[model samples]
Structure formats: C-alpha cells, structure tokens
Target: MAGILVVNERYFPDDELEPAQVGATSFSRSALRCLWNAGLSAGVILYKRAEELTEPQIDLTHRSGFRCATLRFNFDMGADTVSRAIAEAAARLCAAYGFSSRAMLYYQTDALLVFHPQELACCVTHHGPFVHDFVETFSARETAQAFGDAAKALHLFKHQELGVNSVRSNGRMFVLQHSQLQREYLISRGVDERRIRAIRPPIAPPTVSEPLRDERLRSFVEGAELLVFTAVARLDYFKNVELLVSGCVQARKQGVPLRILVVGDSAEDDVARQALRAHVPEELSAEFMAVGKLTKSQLYALFSLARSNGIFVCPSRYETLGITPLEAALSGVCTLMTDSEKVEARRFFPDAHRFLPSGDGLADAIGLAYASPSGVEQLGKELREAIATEISEENFERDTLSAWSYFSQSARQLDS
Candidate 1:
C-alpha cells in the first residue's frame, strides 16, 4: 500500500469522537477521514498512557476502513520511553501497512515524534510539542512558564541535532498552523512563511435534542435593547472567568446595555461558579447571568434567539481552538476574543474584536461595538459567512489530501 501512515496521540473511533476530546481527537480523525475518502489505505498509530495498558505491547486493532496500532508509553517520563514505543510500533505498522522500508510517508496529526525521516508529514500545529506545555489546559500550569525567546531554542536545537521533528522546516514538509500568530511564531523560528498555512479546525455543528426551556433567559432576551454576550467554559482559573466579570462590570458602567450569559460549570462541582457569582458585585447581579450548563441544542437555540444582537466572548488565559466563538459564529453571532497569542481562534476576528486579555481592554472592545451597533451586527453576518466558507468540511478534506499528496511525492522522490 503506497498510502500514508496516519498518527495521533489519543484513540477515539473515527466517527464516535466526543466534544470534550475536540483538539487531539479531531486532529488525526480529520486526516484519516480525508485519507479514506481519497481511497488511501493507511494505518493509524494511537498513543496512550503507560498505565492505561496492562502491558507494554503493540496491539493491531482493525477498524471499518483502516488498521490501528495502539502503543503505550509514559510520555511524562520523557523522550526515551516515547522513542522506544514509536520505534517498535512504526516497524510493525510499516510492515503491516506494506509501507516500503525505503520510503515511509506519515500523515501525523502532530508531527512531534520523528525518530525517523518520517518527519515529512502534513501536521497540525496546535497539537505539536512546541506549544503543548504552553497551552496550559490544567490549573497547575496556569501560573505560567518562562516562555522567553529562548523557551524552545534549546529544545529545538536538541531535536535538530537528533533530526527529530525539527521546526526548521524544509520545503518537503507541510505545517498547518491554527492561527497567523502561530505561523508567525514558526517563521520567527526559521520556517518559511510560504510553506506555513493557517486554518482553524471547524467546530462541529451543534446538534440540539433539547429545546430552549428557560423562561428566565427568555425574559432577559425579551427585555430592553440588550446586547447578549455569551461565554462558555468550565468555571476555572484556566477559563479566566475573572476577566469576564471585570469586563462586564466596566461595560455596564459605560452605559452599555449588556447581559453576560455564561454557559458552563466546573465539570466536577459548582464551587468555582459560586465563587465567580460571589465575585460579581451585588448591584451588577441582575446583569450577569450564569444560566448553568445546557445541552448542545439548547445552547445553539439560545444563540439563535440572541443572534440579532449577540456577541460571543472567549477570555481564556490560553486556548487552542476557542470553540465557543466558532460555534457562536456558526449561530450568526460575532466573536470577541482575548489575545490572539492566547486563543488561536482570535486570528479569525478583526483587531477591534481581539482584545487584550484584561478587564479594561474587554470593556473598551464592548464599548466600541456598542457605539456602532449596525456595523458590529453586520460584521457578525460577514464573520458567519467567512467561518462557513473557511472552516468547512470540504476545505479540511481538500487541504488534508493536498498535504498528504505533497508529502507522499516528496517521500517517493527521496526513495528514488
């Protein structure tokens, strides 16, 4: 089989991936889905934690359209463990997939594990090792790390010396960055800007089985000429609900008739949400509403109702996809986001919408939008159209296949 060897860090059946598993889960699924559509026979290598597997062994699981190779290793223990597992798994996967020893073409969801020349893959940048620790999804990592210019210079130098997943891109490899900020980061690190493509993953369209049944929300929407700003995230430090609180307070003081509706809670408990509620001043209580978590359909219906005068805000301290804003755009609401460097999806919005990740900055952004209602609403419509076109399934399949073809061609040329 002269097909690509598709790989990812996690395992989820191609069609049955969950919403919580969005970033890493979807990365390889999109590639495998496109490769299958192209009539390519590929093997998927899924990496899981060492503890999850009973023993350290490679299991070849056959799926509907492709072969899967599951390899387990304690990635926390560092590169040696990962290298051994990948080396063993790659050998078996190459042999099983009929990939010639001379040319091994990989379509990696994250082109991070390159113990071989299989580094020439169409890789998604958001999941790449270069920015993994920086994204900081966990509260423990929220304090921040020393990401000075020298943040990855030593790391990249080590990888370059080992000829493993080097960011010093040659013309042979393809890197799809989720945002222009990421592309700029790569360019600064010596990748050619021409070879770098920026495209955010499409948020899967919401499927609503639940109806919008909240009377409180209905009355709020029906009340005065209110601008509904929705923010969705588990109530946690990483989500930065503090920024939302501060921003909402400022927006109201500036006479912007706005209602802040938050859509998620800390998955385990409402402690964080309660803390957030208490953090809001007593007088501002009526304006800020945490409607609690709603099902997919209910949420979208809520957005649809508020679409006329709605704006979605993501004030996360750091994020990769910024899914809420994307979903909001799909529901015909414009997006206001924190720094582009913090949330990759911020790249899709104009400068007016991408605010500094601070309370005052957010208030100013909201003030600007309130000042020009018609323009902001029209911009919402334009953004909705742009997201539909730019992040469509058709475009993802096309881009994935195109990169696969490019990598395949380059690998064969090397073999020749």
Candidate 2:
C-alpha cells in the first residue's frame, strides 16, 4: 500500500535541512519525521513547475536519510494565475504518479489553492495569509469575493466509489490551519467547520551559535550606537519589508540612530529593492543594509549579536503563524512584530513588542525601545522562557502525532 505522499515546491535541499531552515521547510521536515515516527510508510513529491522541462524524474537524494520514496517532477505551466497554476500542476502530478486511493495526500500551501483531488483521503496545511492578504491589499468586498471563489473552486471533492457526493460537505480531508484565527477565517469564508482543524506548528528550540567569528557582522553590531534591527523574510509586499526601510527613514528624520539588516532572498536589482533604494533619501541610505541569503552559521551569528541592544522585527501585514518572530524570541532577541489580529501576536507572545503596520507606528515603537530598551530587553528573556516552556519538543511531538492520528482516523473512515 502507498504511504503518505508529501507534496511541496521545495523539498528541503539535502545540505540545508538543519534546524535553521525553520519555516515551511522545517514544517515539511517535521511532518515527514512525524509520519516516520508513527511507523507508517511515507514518500515525498517535490514538484517544480517549468515551461521547458521535458519529463518527470525521481531524485535519489530526497530519499537518502528516510527509507521513503521521493519523486521530482516538473510541470510545464505559466505563473499567470495561482489557481490555474495549481490545477495544471496537479493534473501533471496525477498523470505522472497514478496516485492510489488509499494513500494519504498531504499538500502544502502552493498545492492547496485549486487542486482538490477526488476521493483518496487528502489533507491541506494552510501556511499563507490568504484572507489577511486580501483584506490588507484589497478591500473587504474583494476579500469576501476571493474567499468565495477559493471556497467554491476547492471545497467539493467527490468520493465516487463510496457513492458519496457530499464528502466535502461532511469533512472531505482535514484542513490543518496554522492558527485558530486562520481556521476561523476559513470557516467564515464558507468552509465546513468540521473539516477545519487548527494545529499550531511545533517550534524546535533555537539553535545555539558559537562565539561571533565574522568581523563584518561584529563591526556592524559594535560599530555604532545605532539600534541594530534584523529582519528575515522574502522581499514581498505582504511581508511589508518596505515598512522596515520606511521606519529607518522615519527614525533617522527624528535624529534617532538606527541601522537595519534585512536578510532574505532579496536581490540587489529586484524591483522591490530598487524601489526602496530610490525612495530612501541619500543621507538615510546608509541606515539600511539588504543582505541576501546567508548561511545558517552566519544567521546564528547575527542573531547572537542582536541579543544585546538589538531587535528582530517581523513587520509582515499577514501571517498564518509568524515563525521568524518566535524564532527570534527563542534566540533571546527582543522581537517586534505587527499587531495583526489574524496572527494574534499577543496570544502566542504576550511579552514580545508589537506595532501597527505603518511607517509612523513602526518608527514610534522602535524609537520608544531605542529610548528605553530595558523593558524590551526584559521582554526578550520572558519570551524566550515562554517559548521554551510552551513549545517544548515533547509537546510538539505529542501534538504532531495527535494531528496525524486525527487525520489517519478520518482517512480510515473514507476507506470504510
């Protein structure tokens, strides 16, 4: 019998599977580990959509450590619309893999948009900020319409063999939400409440770093009294990275010393980066530094350096579950984030600093901290202890198994 099939865009590259990869990659690895620990057969399908790639191929390395199968397929498709992209990719996958009915289909965020498989128990892990993205970027009416379209497009999955047309109406696969607010948002958007389950991901303890070795990082941290701020995220609008730059500009205008290091996949010539550079005044340009991707060791060094008089900011406008801020808190850095209701920042972290997603608001928050960092520093220690206690590895293991158990039970019923 086929075991669980994990489908995602990027299958944690073999060399980068360390705990430092603590976003979607970490969750993917954790899910696989959970399934493996449960003694169930499992495999992974790393699907990469391409326009010229000829055929699907199996990756030998993906199945190296785990005694499971792994297939690397390329789908010829355009990035026109997210839904269409997903549907086309799903079609290619179904054609290539002849997916069995008994196998549990677990889809990451990208595959969940429009690929609703018929029969064959499937589950979706919500990782992005769909509703929040719409509301923040568009209007409420647009958000509602977008949610309605998604619901209508992906909700119904037929169980033809079982003579059940209302599988979705009942509980078609489990919809694992990263947060209670996210699950509630899905329910509000007409998804069956029975099919939705909110399972906060298990966060591993932050990896400890050796003493700071990089001289450049050391200089950046100790060079100035500038309140060092570090942000890690994609250079996307919803990530609200521009706000961090805007905040730095605002702080500089107020004669406050501040320096920010943005670490992510931001290229020098990227549109967003270019726009930000042009917008910032020449005088304030030195206040911000955009470092593209860095190794895990480098990241740990930065986090360690920021432990004193520095803060990690996650100014994202929408988040299913903000992992970076939690990770920052774990690393003993004073973490500041947006006060997004959907993210429920306070619910998970009562002590971490928060601000509204605006240039002025972010600047004020940072300014206050810069003036009196004692409270922010104390908050970091509190947050570290809180995360270690609340998200203990033992608790995460138990929760992950419980989540799988619930889905497995639902899958069994479908086979019945």
Candidate 3:
C-alpha cells in the first residue's frame, strides 16, 4: 500500500475554521494523524474553484507539520473536464510526495469534482451535494443569497447529477456516505450499494473555550425564562433562518417565554440575516436575536451558561452530521435538531427535542424544554454519555483509517 492523500475543495490553508463548526477539515486533519500513526506518509491536497485567479495555480507548501498541495482553477468548465483536471493534479502530487501511482486518495468533500476514479485509487466521502441545499431552500433564498437564479440552480443540479453518477463509477473507487438518508438517495439515483459505506460523523467532547461575553446577550438571557442557543456558521438560506423566527413567533403567541441566543454572522449572505429579521414581529423581536460571530472560547462560555437554563437548536433544512448539536449535548445542554432522516442527530441523538421542520412543531419542541427543564437536562446528560461510550476518539480514528485501508488494500489487489 502507498501513502494517503486527502482532498477537499472547500479547504483553504489561510481560513480559520472553528473546531466546533467544521467537521470536514477536522476529519481531514485526523486522517493525516491516523496515517502517520500507521507509519505511512500522508498529505493534504486543497482544490478550489476560483474564477478570480484568472490563471490556474497549483503549488506545494509545507504548513504546520503537514505537507500541503493546493490547486485553484475556474468552475465554469464541463464536469468531466473539471473532474479530470483534479484527478490529474492528485496524480502529480502523489509522485512528488514519493507515493506510487496507486496512492490512496481520500476525497473529503462531496463537490464530486473528481470522477475518474480508475486513474486514481479513491474513496469519495459525500459530505453533501450543493444541489441538496439549493433545492431544499429554493423558496427561502433571495436573489442576493447565491441560489435564487435559474441558471445557477440548474448548474448545481447538473453537477449533483454527475457527482452522484460516480458513487459506483469505478471498480477500485469506493464511496462513503455520512448519513443513511444520503446513502439511500444515492442508491435511488442508481449508485451501486456495494461501493458505499454509511458512517455518521464522529463526535468528540469539546475542550473548554472562552465564554462569549456581550452586554446585549447578557441582558436578554437575564430576562429569559428559557435560553435557546443556536450557532450558525453562516446565515445562509439552507440554515432556514426564517423557520427559526417563525417558530419563535408561534411559541411567543402561545405565551412560551424564551430567548434564543444566535451566535453567527451573515457575512456570506447578508440577505438571509435581513430576511430573518423581517420575519420577526416587533412584539417578539427580543425573543430571537443574532449576536454575530464569536470566538470558539466565547461559544463554549455560552454553552456553559446553558447547563442551567439553556438548550441548543439546529434549524437546518439539510444537515450532514452537524457538529454543533453534539458539542452542545456534550456541554450538558439538551440539543434540539430539526427532524430529518438526513440528519445524524435523528439517528444518534435522543428524540426528546427532535422537532418537525415547521412552525408548530418547532414551537412545541421549545415548549417541551420550557415545561420540563429537568427532562431536557437529563436528555443532555444521557446524550453525552451515550455518544461518549459508543464513539471515542480511539474508536473513531480506527473506523476512519480502516475504511481507507479496506479500499486501499483492494486497489492493491486489483493491481496484483
């Protein structure tokens, strides 16, 4: 077997991703560690679609004890052409890093930018297809929010079709689906079941981080009968911000006294933030307030406050094993998530706070936390214990490495 090469299109070396908010980068980071532990060399290959760079640029650099190679190209090309370009880039990186032609390539993002698996020993992890969010939140997305146009939506849909086509595209290529719903979807799209592995995203207990301190947030929590903490990495349409506000409206009408502390920024889609605020009535404006981006430490500090009077809520239309809910559960806050089979929470988390993705359902779920605070607290403890007992760092690492090894070893067999 040769070394491993991890590739993710969204990964940029310069960006700082909070550990709690990002699971893809962490999984790639952990893959490097696991490979090193097995006495094999490993490196990361970042591929991105950049229309601004004008010219394609691919370079290698050593960063933070890891060998990193980056490829930046434009996205307007044909799907087959883009996939071929990425595969060629990985082949070149493998040779430069002293890996054989058949080096194991772990494609981290479901961008499905690489389809020529026969030319590369690959295992594509379907984090999610861009089209999933595009269609799910179509009505909610405003023209400025990136998915409102017919051309772009069709563009995403086209690639999603091609991307799913590669689930069983090659004999040597294996696929990993992060959620069961995604796996079923792929199967429905004619992907071979033999090549796909279903693995939920791993959850680890969060380390202590600084508490989020804001005077405005402090005052709101002070007057709240129940505190609901929500962490939005980006206030995008798929995050379903309107749904959150609408649910709060329903709850407030029923006289459910609560305050939702939202920590995130709408920098990616300011329109989403604007639309969310518009959905709120003046009477219940304080019921839901978004306190923009906070540091990791500050978020933990916020999570700690929830141990007594708070719970975490994820109101996403499409979620691929979101790390926030699990992290909050570990912090002893009952983590509530929108009920969807595609969500990992539905499979792993307790049903105590699971809510239908609607106004009345979301409101009722919040009411459950408000009416039986102790029950919510106990659910948090139970979730923490159950996940901790079943999926530890050691076990998660082992399972990840084993999946790669199984595919890599198969590639070697075919070569022999």
Candidate 4:
C-alpha cells in the first residue's frame, strides 16, 4: 500500500476528505476529497507556524534574509524557539519518510507560496528522488514562482540535470483562458505539456431542493426599481468591494435608482464601508445593504430572490475565474463583471455582461443590464442552459476521472 501525504495549511470538510461526498465543504476539504476518491492512500498533514524551520532546511537553498522573512510572515516570528521546534519537527518527518514517501504535496493559503519559490524548490530537492506534486488553490506571481521552482527542483533531483523535466506548471484561474495562451505560457516555461493541468477550483454544489427566499430579501429586491449590485468576498484589496459601492452611489447621482448589497464578513475592516457611510446620501445608504456574511442557505435564498428581481455585479480587481458570476448565471440572474484584460469572463458570459476600464464603466454596464430586462431574461435563460449542459454530474465525473488517471500515472512513475 502506497501512502500519499497531503500537506495543507488549512482544515478541510469531511465531504472533501474521502469517498468524494460533494455538496458544501471547505475548499481544502473538497480538494482532499477529490484526491482521495481517486484511489490514492492519502492522509492530511497540517503545517502550523510553530512547526517551521529556523535555519534553512535544505542546503544552499534559500538566502538567510529570505528564510527569515518567510518565517516571519508565516509564523510571526523573527527568531524564536518555536521556529526551531517547528523546523525540527518538519526535518524529522522528512528524514523518516525519505524521498520514497509516495508523493509530497503542498498547499498554502497566504502569499508565502507566491514569494518563496526557491526555498520551496530547495525543500523538495533536499527530500530527494521522490515524486513531488505541488498544488495551490490561490497564488499570485511570486508564489507561483515558488511552485515552479519546486517542480524544477524535483526534475533536477530525478534526472540529474535541468532541461525540460525541471519544472511542471499548473496555473489555477477563476476564469478559463483561451487555450492558445494557456498552452503557450506552459511551453515557454519549459513545463511538460502533459504535466500542466488546468483544474478549475470546484464550488460545493448547492443542495436546496427548493429556493429559500425570505420575504425581507424578496421585498428588498422587488422594491429596488433600477439596479441591484451584490458582492460576496472577503474585505481584501483584490476584492474591490468599494468599487461596487462607489459605482452605486455614482449611478444614483446620475438619477439611476441603483441599490447595492455587499455581503460576506470583513466589512467592518473595509475602509470603503466607512467611506460609503460618509459619502452615500442617507436615502441611498438605505438602498445599499451591507449585510455581512450569511449562511450558505441564506445566501442561496438571497440569490434566488435577486434573480427574480435584479442584476448581480462582481467588480473584482483580479479574479482568477470568478465563481459568483457563474452562480448568479445559474440562479437566473444577470451579471455585470469587470473586464480585466487577462480574465476570460466572455468565455463564460456574453459580451454585454462584462464592463471593462473603470468603476464608472461598471455603472454604465449596470444601466445596460437594467435597460433591457427582457434581454437580460433571455441571457439568464441561456446562462442556465449552458451551466446545466456543462456542469452536470456526468461532466464532473468525466473530468475528475481524467484528473485521477493523470495523477495515478505520476504516482506509479514515482513508485518505479
């Protein structure tokens, strides 16, 4: 029996663990479940800040400043006893298991994955001639390099030279990209085309047999005459929740009766929330509801009500592939998303559904969506049909099985 060790920095839900039980699990859990269902003997390993190394774990791997900086960011320590303890624990585990320990996987939540490519590569290389696979759900340019470096290191360790197998690429995006650009990027990076798999992150399928629209939410949507913009993302720089609020305010000033709903927690930390409170006219503020995080059921119910009433807007500064828009599309709601040049929202939605350039442009797009409710309705119907055709259980099974086959082949190669 081969043991597959999955090193993740966060907790996963049970459904995302084994047996592949879908429907409402955390992101990490869903990924784990996906891996387990593929028939690999996998177990989870959580890496805490207290368990990181003080000095470099692998020789000539990471620079001293880089190592310290990584530790500081990940563990909140400049130099401490806890850091040493964590380092020892990781070293022991690596030494005991050796490079033959099935497959070593790493998944992280913070920006560390983006910054420390060389260190990660060194760690994997030090561990050895074992098969190494790197998986990241969210990563920026810096962290992506770390992932690339780890792949590169694995190739060098196994082949004894750096040529083609030195690195493998798997870039996760919220929106699918044109196949040509994706392929070109992979090839340019010297990644094995076979090794680079574009696995779109999965959302826990909604399970309510019937929609759960409460009277308050329904009434709220129904009463809103012009436009209703909504966003459900953490209060982070990239989310650009403020853009929606500001756009709504601008739309109202322009004589548009636009109402906005900014959902999810972290609103308290949002400077924009404060700015909106100060800038939005009292009448307009009433129209804009900043209801914090709601339960999944509550969110779905609200979505259903919104579909029956208004348009959904996702004004993210950067979304690898925005899922909310897809959810809105499925719920029979029209969406107006930002047109980040790199993103491929058009692949998923009609051109009319996207607005590029600025927040003012988003306001303009909202008006467009509102101007032709009948056309929006037609778009909604089309969206639902597309989702139904593309995201069925059969489709999930086919894609998932294909992914498993690829992983299985890699695992066998490692065993050999």
Candidate 5:
C-alpha cells in the first residue's frame, strides 16, 4: 500500500497536540483533516522554531486511525538555506523509512522549495505565483507605491516569474480553483493544463450544531459605542489588512459606525500592525482592535457573537478558495470580500458582494452593507445554504478520491 507525505512549511495539527501549540492555518488544518478522512496514510512533515525543538526527532503517530509521521526541524538557519536543508532532510527521512515514489508527496500550498519539483504534487493556494496579474486587479503600480517601495515591487515580479517556472516544472500542480475566473488565471500564468487539477478546500462541520451567541459579547459591543466587523487571517501582506484599515477611516468619515476586530497573527504581524497604525487617523485610533491570534474555541465564540447584520470581511488580495469568508458565512456573519478570482465568495455571490482592495472601493462596500442591513444578512444566510448544498462532506470525499485516483493512475502508467 502506498502512503503520502504531506509537506507544508508550517506546523500541521495533530489532535494530540496542545491547543496553544497548534500553529496550522485554519485552511491547512481543514485540508489535513480532509486528507486523513479520505483514508490516505498521510505522513505530515512540518517545521518547529529553534526554541521548540529539544532534539532532532521523527515519530510515527496516528490520529483517529490515520497514520502519519512528524518530522520536527530546528529553525537555526535562514529560509533560503534552510529550504534546501529541509528538502535533503526529508529525502533522507523517507529513504530511512522506505517512503517511495509510489507514495506521492503533497504540498498544501505553492511551496515547492522543500523538495525536488518533479518529485511531488503542489497546490497553489494563493496568487503569489501570479502577483503581477493580481496587482493589475487592484491597480498594481499605485498599490505598490502605496505599499512603500521598489524592492517589494521587484520581488513580486521575481516571485511570479520563478514561481510559474517552478509550477511548470513540477510533477503535478493542483490549482484549488472553484470558478472559471480562477481557472483561467492559472492557465494564463503557464501552469500546464494537463497537470492542473481544480479543487475547493473543504469546509469542516462547525463544532456546534447551533452556535451559542454569547450574550456578554453583545452587551460589550453595545456598551462600547461601536459596531463590530470581524476578520480572521494571518497578519500577512496578501491579506491586504492595511487597505482595510484605510477603508475603515473612509467609512467612518462617511458617518458609518464601524470598528474592526482582527484575529490571527504571525512573526510578520508587527510589520502589518505598524502599517495599519500609520494609516489610522488620530480621531479613529481606537476604532481598530487587533487581538492578535486566538484559540479555535475563542474564534468560534467570536463568530457566535456576530449580529444579524454584523460583517466579516476578507480583504485578501488573492486566495485559493479562501476558507475564512466561508467560515464567516457558515457562522451566519454577513460577508464582504476582495474580488479574489479564486475566492468562493465570488463563485457563489454576485459582484455586489466583493470589493477591490482599495480604500474607496472597500469603503463603498461597507457603506452598502451598512445601508441595507437586512438584505446583507439575507445574503449571508443564502451563502451558508449554498455552502451546505454545494460543498458538502460528500462532495469533498468524491473530489479527494478523484484527485488521488488521477495521481495513482498517472504514476502506474509511468512505471509501466
């Protein structure tokens, strides 16, 4: 029987792991769950901070019947050098344990740096590979200048060029695109049509059949003299949180009563936080609150506290079926998102539901949601229904099986 090696640079969730130490993104956590549920013997390899590693270790583990391997790395080296080290380390680990070519390697994101491109299948979960193309959607040149430098612009271009080349050279490239808009973007960027497989990231069932909206949360919002709009994501550049901050100022000037609560953080959070602080006007200083990262239970509690017209905005500049907006929708929070070609919000909702990652555009979307609260809430309800009907567990299972079958057959054909 063939097994799979799931490679993601960040930590993957092992239920046995402590909540405080679970560092996987919500999307990655869901994808890992879906893979395990599909009956694949998945061995997850992830990194640990230098401090988190007491010794070099590899362990065979199982979670709810799914067998996996945990390869913990000590992050004493810089990324560029460490990537090659991790790749060579992984190959040695596999060789020592007999993980073979019959066992396909799966990347959770467009991260091909850790392994030989021809030895694994990778998923493009964002538009980093096509940043130039995405930049055009939000007015690339001006946005770059607004973001503050030429080096950043050059990096975007370089990343796209190198990333596309990497994709083209890979054994297989999975584009997690749910719409024609997303699929076309990948094809235009040089991803081989034959090697591309479009799949939606799975949405796990909520921990509760019905979320208990904390009454104290409602009272606190009412007492604070603010209306809350919640967003959850790693504090990263592609999240376009700086633009969201600018738009909030614009919305407040327009007499819209709004404040933002940001959840999630990263080592890069300080950079993003500083940029947001610089954008905030003196009068609106307290209008934005970033609580940094939260536990999964805490996140669900926040979701439960969402009012009928409360909004959840995903200001990401790009995505591969961004799962946060869907989580918000499922939580019954009205959702507004950026016009990411791969975001499922665009796949399921009308154009009115999306905004560009520009100050004026995002302000307008928020103002509109504010203007017609009932309509916005109804739309959120419809989005939730659509997710349940269109992206069900059964659908996820079928898609998982289909992707596995394709890879398995292709591998056999090559061997024959």
Candidate 6:
C-alpha cells in the first residue's frame, strides 16, 4: 500500500476547543478517513510552533504593502511574538517530512500552505484566492509569488487538487467557478492544468444508527405551533446569520409565527444573540433562540426533529456545497437554501425556488415556507427517495476507491 502524509495546522488545547476549531478539525479528520477507507495508507502531522516566522523565506512572494499587512496581523510589536506560529510550525513539519520528495499536503486553508513550497509535492485546498489574495492578509507580491511558485512547483511538484463542497452561483459566476478560476489563474501563472483536479466534498454518514434527543429539544419541537426556521452553521461571515435573523423578523412581520433555532457559536461574543435581542422586534426576537455549540447527539436530534417537521433553511452568502442540507435530506427534512444557480444544492433538489434567495428575497421565502410547511414535508420525501438512490455507502466506497486509485497512480508516477 502507498503511504500519504496529511498535514494540518489547527490543533486545539482541550480547554480552547471552539466550534470553528472543531469544525475545521472534523473536516480534516473526515477527509483523511475517506482517504484511508479508500485503501490508501495515511498519517497525520500536526504543527505546534512558538514563533510565526523565524526568517523571511521568499521576499518576491509578497508585495511590500502586503508584507507590511502580513507583519501587522502576524507579529505583535508589544510582545514580539508571531501570531502565525501554527502556520510556521506546519511549514517546518512539511520541510522535515521532505514533502517535495514524497508526500502531498492536504491543507485546511491557504495560509498554512503558502510559506512551504519546498516541502510539498502537491496541495489540496478548499477555499481559493479570497484568503491568499487578501490585501489585509498578505502582500500582493507575496500572493503573486505564491501562485507563481505553486504553478512552477506543479511541474516538478506533483499535483494540486481543489475540493469544492458546495454548488452555488452568484454575481455572474458560480461558486464552483471560484475553484475553476483559481486553477485557471494558477495555470495562467504557469501551473499545469493537467495536475489540477476538482473533487466534490463528501459527507460522512451519521455515526449513530438511532437518533438521540434531550428533553429541551423534545419540548421545543413538541410545543412548536408555528413553523420552525432552522439553521446550523459556525457563526461566520460566510454563514450570513444576520440575514437569517432579519429574514425571520420579516417573516414574523408578514404574520408568520416562525420560530428559528440557530445552532453554533457566534464569533462576535454573543453579538448574534444580542442583535436578535435588541434589533429584532419583540415577537420575532422572542421566537429566536441562539443555542451555542451542540454535541453530535444534540445535532442529530435537531436533524431528526427538523426531518419530522420539514423546515430547514441555510441562508449562506456563499456555499461550496452545504453539507447540512444533505444531512437534512437524509433525515427526511425539507430545506431552503439561498439561490446560487451554480451550486449542486439546486441541482440536487431541482425545486430550487422553494428555498429563499439571497438579499431581498429571503424574507418572502421564509414567509412562504411558513405558509406551506407540508411543502417541506413533500420536498423531504422527494429528497429522501433521491438521496436513497444517490448517496449510499456503496457509492461512497466506490468514489473513494476511485480517488485512491488516482492517488496511488500519481504516487507511482512520482516514485518513477
């Protein structure tokens, strides 16, 4: 069996473990597990660093302005400590592993992969240029050079795979286009397109065969008289929680007594909870409950409840492929997501307009969902049947095996 090394930068202390960290770690672990289950042998290398940067490895990789910004964000003048110790440590680990000679790097984010060209054979990434091309985050020169190096490295480097999980399109481009564009842009900068592959993100089946529910959740679902607008996401800009809250308020204004359950923690330290409290009208805010991070059992319970009730909504600004909707579909829950014409969600559902659209159309969609709760049930039935046909352990195994076959062949070619 061929061996693969997976490198990740996000390692949390038991006490410091938060939802974002948990989510990132879970994604990384799941991807690794998928690789392993596909029959490829793999190991994980975690980074622990004390300093963010010991030396500037490549000055040409970043523009002067971008370098200053990176320094500002990553270095503490008062403490003289680098905030990016994790990324720096990841670089060291990659170098130590002689990644260029043997292993491929499956990166959680672009930041960790940027500074370590010499240590990697190829990189598999989720997000595209948004993170790497940030003016506030890195210098243009740095961004330019990183792309340039990544492209050059591609010829000798091995492969670069882009894993996109969601399918949505907006503002004249589909979400998948971002990955395609990134690949194209890298190719324009001299990376070989043949080395690039786009893989749809996979969802892991539920761990438990049976669903578990707590008394609070049981009571909440049992007593619900009106529609339940449900959304679960790590509170982040991409999630667009405020839009959901606002949409809920609008739904209530239109005489829909909708109760929304928001799972996951807000980044702004209870800012979402507070905003719902003060900004949302009394009835709407009263109907809103922001339950922070939940255990897997609790989440499954929510899924079960939503499945039974037929009301799930994801109003993300951008989604590569929203996994929650698939989970909801598997649970027999009807879901409404933002209309991104390019995403697989609509393709998966087909009855796309039933879900809300981004911006102004959300409130109307929520109101519509309230008016026709049974519509969600019917949709759920359709989804359940469709998912039963499409997503099975057998198919997952097949696809995973195919991915492994490709990986192994690539490994052999590199070895040759």
Best by lDDT: 3
Candidate 2 pairs with clashing backbones:
none
TM-scores, in order shown?
0.71, 0.76, 0.83, 0.63, 0.71, 0.67
lDDT (Cα atoms) of all candidates against the true structure: 0.60, 0.59, 0.66, 0.47, 0.58, 0.49
Residue 111's lDDT within candidate 6 is: 38
Instruction: Provide the global lDDT of candidate 6 against the true structure.
Output: 0.49
Total backbone collisions for each predicted model: 1, 0, 6, 14, 0, 17
Best by TM-score: 3
Write down the worst ten-residue block by lDDT for model 5.
Answer: 15-24
Q: 307-358, model 3: which lDDT tens digit per residue?
A: 6677688887666667667667777777778887646556666676689989
Count of backbone collisions within predicted model 5: 0
State the lDDT of candidate 6 residue by residue for 1-416, as single tens digits.
32333333333222222343434444454555565565443344443333565532211121111110112122222222232332343344434434433434444543333333332243444442343223334455544443455454342222222222111111111111214435544555444444455544455446453454457655666566544555454566556677777776766677766677776664346765565456567645556667665554556667766665546777765454566666666667666667754234455665543455543577776666556646666767776677666655555556544554564465456556
lDDT of 5 by residue, 354-395 (tens): 788688988998888888746656766766775567665566
Better of 2 and 4 by TM-score: 2
Candidate 4, position 140, lDDT: 45
Off by over 4 Å in 3: 2-10, 15-23, 50-56, 75-101, 110-117, 130-148, 213-223, 266-270, 295-297, 373-375
**lDDT of each residue in 77-178, candidate 2, tens digit only:** 223343333333344444434543345556665343233444456666756555443455566554444445545323321112121222245364667666
Model 3 lDDT-worst window of ten: 12-21
Q: Once superposed on the true structure, which residue ranges of model 4 sit more than 4 Å away at CA? A: 1-26, 36-38, 51-188, 204-219, 253-255, 267-272, 344-346, 373-378, 392-397
lDDT per residue for candidate 1 within 363-386, as digits (tens), equals: 988888767757556767777787
lDDT at 67, model 4: 14
Name every residue pair that clashes in candidate 5.
Answer: none
TM-score for candidate 3, residues paired by index:
0.83
